[model samples]
Target: MNVRTHILRRNNTGGIFHQRGVAALLLVLLVGISATVVTLGTMSYVRGSQKSQLTVHGQTQAEINAWSGAEALGQYLNGIEVETVTTAMDDIVFSRDNQTIASAQYKPDCSQTSRDLYCFDVNGISAGHNSNLEVVYQIPIIRDVSYTEISNPIVIKGDTEVTGGGMAYLSSDSIDGFAVDGNLTITNATKSIASGCATGNIHVNGGGVEDNGHLYSSNGDITLEGLNLVGADIWGGNINVLAGSGFHFKSIKAVKNLKVTNAGNFKSDFIHANAVSFALEGQLGETLVHSDIAFGNGKSHLDYLEAGGNLIFHQDDQSHVPEFTRNSKIAGKILLRTGEDGNTLSTHYNSTFKNIEQGRTATDPGVPEWPECNVDATPFDVNTLISQANYIFYIDESDKPMLKIQNVKRASDDKSIDATINLSSEGGMNTAYLHNKPFFQCEWDSKSCITSKSNSTDGWVFEGVTHFPPGVILFAGKGNPNQRNLAPMNFTLASKSEKVGPLLNTILVTGDITLGRGGGRKEIHAPYFSSPDAVCDGDFYPANLCDKSSGSWQFEGKWDGDRVERNYPVANTSIMVNHTMTSEGWSLEGSVIVGDTFKTDSNLTNVHGVVVIGLNSDEGGMKITQGGIVVDFMDLDSNFLNIPTGNTQVTDESTLGIPTAMWARYY
Candidate 1:
């Protein structure tokens, strides 16, 4: 505004104005730089978000496709005929919409040694993701392990070689494998194998020779010692390990005369012998045997020991017994297999025990009772079979009874009761297992009865005239054995009786057999039978014993063995029985049980087959004094015990436990 008029003054003002102008320009440049930085940062953020989403989606798709590849491989394997030789992949591809999505390499797992075992290992890839899966398809053979009754001894000798107990499971409760009633001698050096069947046992009678196996007489004091025993088990005759030797890994069990010689370093889970003798062995892992340690002289480690006869700490001569070393102690508990509270172990030494428990005689198979009867049993004569041999009855629980009887006298309360058999009076079956066809009675001409494809039909075996798929049997009783205060009901034959299983043909009892008991305070007497012969005419109180055209029964006691087909009886199985039992000359074939409290002064009576006694009772016990002898168990062909034919690993599903695409990885 002042123009050239104040030239001199303007010159001075011009310098200050120029400085302000320069400052304004610098501010504009800074604003432009800030705008450019904001725009670039926003663009970079958007681009990063897009890339993250794409990567996530792509990886997820890759995993899903990889699983798809696995499923495809599974289908192929399922369809192909399996061979022992593994099948390798030859550029096989899986696609969707004609676009390749997955590829897999499958290698079958087959055992040439085992004719019918197969499996598959699949390696799959999709996009960049990969997965590996294993699938089994077949089962193994039954002969991999078996135990037959052998007369000759089985001897194995070799340092490196092994007489495997055969390939089977190994555990405390049950094992699968074979057992020999005769002697099994494993001397030389090879380690013996243990039986692995749960329902099966391997017993040696001639005496287990651990001759590098064992050293004992045949049928004499049994000494369970397989030549080179690693985990094998032997249950022949009376067991005695008194050869002044030591055991490393062992479970010595015997029916009688069990003596351990403390001469070797012992290590194992148990020494469950009838006459178990050990001293000063603690549970360092499992108790190990030491040669220096003597019987009853020191501390001994044991899980459990149940003696049928007298539990002796030393042999008769006391030569095999050792003196206590280190400390006189019993590391674990020792159980006497009897219900007598006052029964004591004959220990003749001054020692200390941690725990010494008592085993009460009782049955613990909590099988439920029945509900009703469907059998149409007509009144008939109770005699006629007195001329035949003894009678055997297989009693089981049932929901539907096919035979009905009325007005029968009970053994315990001496009362008459009407009941139906094969019928349950309370609930349904514990297991809803229905056989495809009868085990016997081959439906006229059904080709599927003899042989089956496991899935197509129910496998069955029927011998003699006795039918397979027999209806479950029910005994009439009003007592619950589980409750000690509650009394049991009885269905007895005479004064002394027992129940023998497996009506080889058809067991016919010609006496009053009472069944179907509700609830009462009475003892249930379950008995096994003996060999019956023809009763003399004078023995028959009623003349027309066989001809019972009338309702009243004519015979006092008579059971016939005529309905049997093949003689297979189930043994050592948990059965339902009452508290009190009394019988002499009873030969129960199939299993073993011991320790009675009843003091019955009897004569020399020999017992064969499976004789189970002194179990599931806290009441008065029994003691069979004098001439009563308990023998070994031998029959196996006809029994309720079923051993799996194929390998234990196989299942009905056929895929083992592996999964296809529908499976989640278990890390």
Candidate 2:
């Protein structure tokens, strides 16, 4: 019985041990499984974090690339010529690591906001990331003049003196300032003057100065008396404002003394001078006076004042009476220093001062520099135009004195042709006639015309037989007499057309161009002699018939003679003369460029276009005698002629693609 019981106990113990071992094994397997799951989860998390970081880097890179492309395009536009900027605004690609990373293109129709503004759009790509950027910039107007360094585009090499009630009206655009190398004095009562820049003194007595532009004097004084000076900045050596003048200026800077007396209704933004003496009634802005200040009897309003010397308030006779009632007010600070004899700031009755500061060292206000004049003798070469000409005619001693052009074939292949020909003259009656057909028989002395083909052979003819091709006409006189050729002959163009048509012709003469002097009245209607359509007409030269009753030749009761007219709206007519261009009782339309003098005498003359005088000599300028001359530039277009590449003057306001505004987005 004991042996059987012991065997049962052994079997039970073995079974319990087997069960414990199996349980331990199962616990080990569970621990292993949990560790494996944790490892896999950690790996997955790491991978995901790396991917997110790479995406962010790519997005940032794309944005940077887009910004860089925009900048690059701006730089390119800044370096290239302004005329080519529009063409360069096409699609432009940027590459990195031998791959195209970004592209830039111009945004069209954006100029409607402002003609000076330009817009650009850019796109960048990096590692499947895209970015877009838009940039905007502003540009300024570009002006082309004869000299790049000259501040004034219209230059008279010598003095311009108009005296004795002569009516001389000079005007120009703001960009094209007028200049005289020598003195400029206008003593007429009916003068309407614009802005002027001079190397010498500028004196004006009795006239109206327009609010056109600024006046700059390099080394001389500027004096104004008995006139109305309006809205102009005067910078010069000295400025003198006398009695009976109405003054309104933005700023006045004088190197020497600035004297003002009886300046009625005076106003200025800023005034700087070495010595200032004012006895005026007006408002003044910031003023910097280097020397002593003499403020006389006047009611003045001042903004800021800085005086290097003694500031005194006295009467017109320089007597400092305490009872002198001078009401003056200051809005800002007053800076002053003690002058001779320990004399400092002095105030009159009813005078007000603000933030007065004394016992300070005075500062020197430097002088303003003068503008340079570097004009070229010839801005363009006449010989260079030869290759571009379609018809070349050389008139020398062999050609007839009276050359007639009739029934010539018009060039139909091209829009325009350039004619380089010479017109001959002899016996003081030498005339050149360019006519299309027989249209009118006009009497010069009577200023009357009869539209009859029977009498057309005797007088100027204007039948519609043919038309002169539209082109640039050049008239070159014989070479210089002292050199080898004969004396320069005057270019006289007499045109008789039945019907005046749309004319597009630029006439360039090497010598003199005379009108309204001979027995017959001269007329020029170009692009052709005459046409039946009658598209153009002038003062004396009518479109269909030369009827004096219908057209009044008298202009301002002064001019009554021949007429050179281009009725076309476009600026297709121009006249350039190397020497004198004289017009008597004549009216013209187009640009006039004279190398020497432009003269008008005993008649009224009206000109529409740019007038550039004194291109060859410093002795002669403009001479107008007993007549009125009016030149209006606003009637002509700016692109009438091509500006030379070397003579272009760009203003400070123009900058190439400055990138004023920018916007960016990423996808």
Candidate 3:
């Protein structure tokens, strides 16, 4: 029984040992499964991190490529030859290693208030990622001198009559034309009128007319009496060729009638007239007459004559016969309107008629409509100048000091006055005067009060004087226009000293401006005026003064005193006058816009720049009585004029575009 108990105890212990072994095995399997799950989780996290890093790098590369594309577009725009962005453009690509990294396109947005603004869109692709960037830019607008009415050398709103002994030569290198709103009469003087348009009659009496251009008398006749007309195409209502007149014309078109009486050497390439009458002797080339034609008395030569009505050959004397060349063709019926002898008519028909057909067709070149006048005389009121003026001066006869000066603050950071005006009195004549004592310094030796400052912060300086750095001087006369007793503001610049008078730029005068004394020694010297940013030291004028290789700024003025020889460059200064501008033998430079007549009595030595006449009034024109003036028109740069703000259109082909503003953004 003891042995049996021992065996059961042993079996029990063995069973307990087996159960512990099973628990150990189960613990080992649990550890292995936990390790496998942790390893799999770690592997998945590592793969996800690597994929996220690649995606971030691709996006960064795409953004960089977009910026690069924007830069490339900017470079392309800078390299293009066109001045302004006219239309939407595309197809600009940035590529490397034969792979396109980005593409850019230019899109113009003209609907905005700023007209010249544009935008560029850049799309970048790198490593399967894409990005977009938009860049905005603004372009500056540059105006040209051709857009202004001052481009013409002469603009006259009223009658222009050259009636002196000396010749009046009108020519321009830029436009070679003149505009006259009224009658253009050149009598007793030799005048060379360029391509011109006259609203009234054009009468050339005893003067020579040589223009290699067209002349149109829009509403009246063209009378050439005792003159030589050469190289001109004339269009008028009636062309009357009086006695002893010679014509070498390209073409002549008369709407009403063309009469030639005892005219010598009438030659034209083509002639069209409603009714033509030739008496005495004349020569005519290819002519088309809409109505009747009468050839009387003298031997006449006609080539290719086409008449809509009858072609009459009248013989007052039996000996005189109207002869024509074999090239002559008559499209109308030949009739002896006022000849008693039928035998003379038969002889003339046999000698003159080459081809006479009643039903032959003739092309009528219709009369050209009158050319529009290029004179844009928009009245520039003095009040407008006053509103924009930095300094205003009023001259009154009643005040103790005749001159009153007023300074206006145009900007917050305005600089001190850096300009001067010289006033001098010579031989009881008050030549120059400016009121302010601080701005005027007297030179005791020359008896002249020189107005000048020591330094200037802005504007251009010439011969120790600053002009229009950012200032404009206005001279107003406190006088009534209707009352002759109360004198209007008349500023006469008569210099008896060696130095010039007040050299002012961009001046507005409400009164008349008399340049120089009659037969006096006063001379004016001015340099080429430009903007403050202009580099005047190149091939241009004021720069050419320092260049010894270039000749002196040609001054052909005959100064009366010790000839003050200085560089007189072509000035771009503006002188606006409300009344007549009388030049009494003075040498003047710069542009002058006159509201009244530009009258010259003595010899005008040298007159440079453009002269706009009859701006405010239609009663006055250019009247040169004695002196022979030469107006050398210089094209002023666009920077001198006021540029209006807004969306700028590409109006001129010579415009220059500059990128003013730029911004970029990523999308």
Residue pairs in candidate 2 whose N, alpha carbon or C atoms collide under 3 angstroms = 437-463, 438-463, 439-462, 462-497, 462-498, 558-604, 559-604
Residue-level lDDT of model 2, residues 596-641, one tens digit each, is 7777655666555445666666675766544545655553334432
Q: Quote the RMSD, in angstroms, for model 3.
A: 25.8
Stretches > 4 Å off in candidate 2 = 1-153, 164-173, 279-282, 315-355, 371-471, 474-476, 479-487, 492-504, 517-573, 602-604, 626-628, 635-667
List model 1 lDDT by residue over 509-599, tens digit each: 2111221111211121112221221111111111111113255332322222321111112111112232333333333332222221222
TM-score of each: 0.21, 0.52, 0.55
Model 2 TM-score is 0.52
Total backbone collisions for each predicted model? 110, 7, 3
Order of the predicted models by TM-score, top scorer first: 3, 2, 1
Comparison by lDDT, 1 against 2, better one: 2
lDDT of 3: 0.48
lDDT of 1: 0.26
CA lDDT scores, all candidates in order? 0.26, 0.46, 0.48
The list of candidate 3 runs beyond 4 A from truth reads 1-151, 165-174, 316-331, 337-352, 359-368, 386-392, 396-415, 418-445, 448-473, 479-488, 496-507, 518-574, 634-667
- Displacement of residue 52 (Cα, Å) in model 3 is 68
Model 1 TM-score is 0.21
- Which whole-number lDDT from 0 to 100 does residue 232 have in model 2? 75
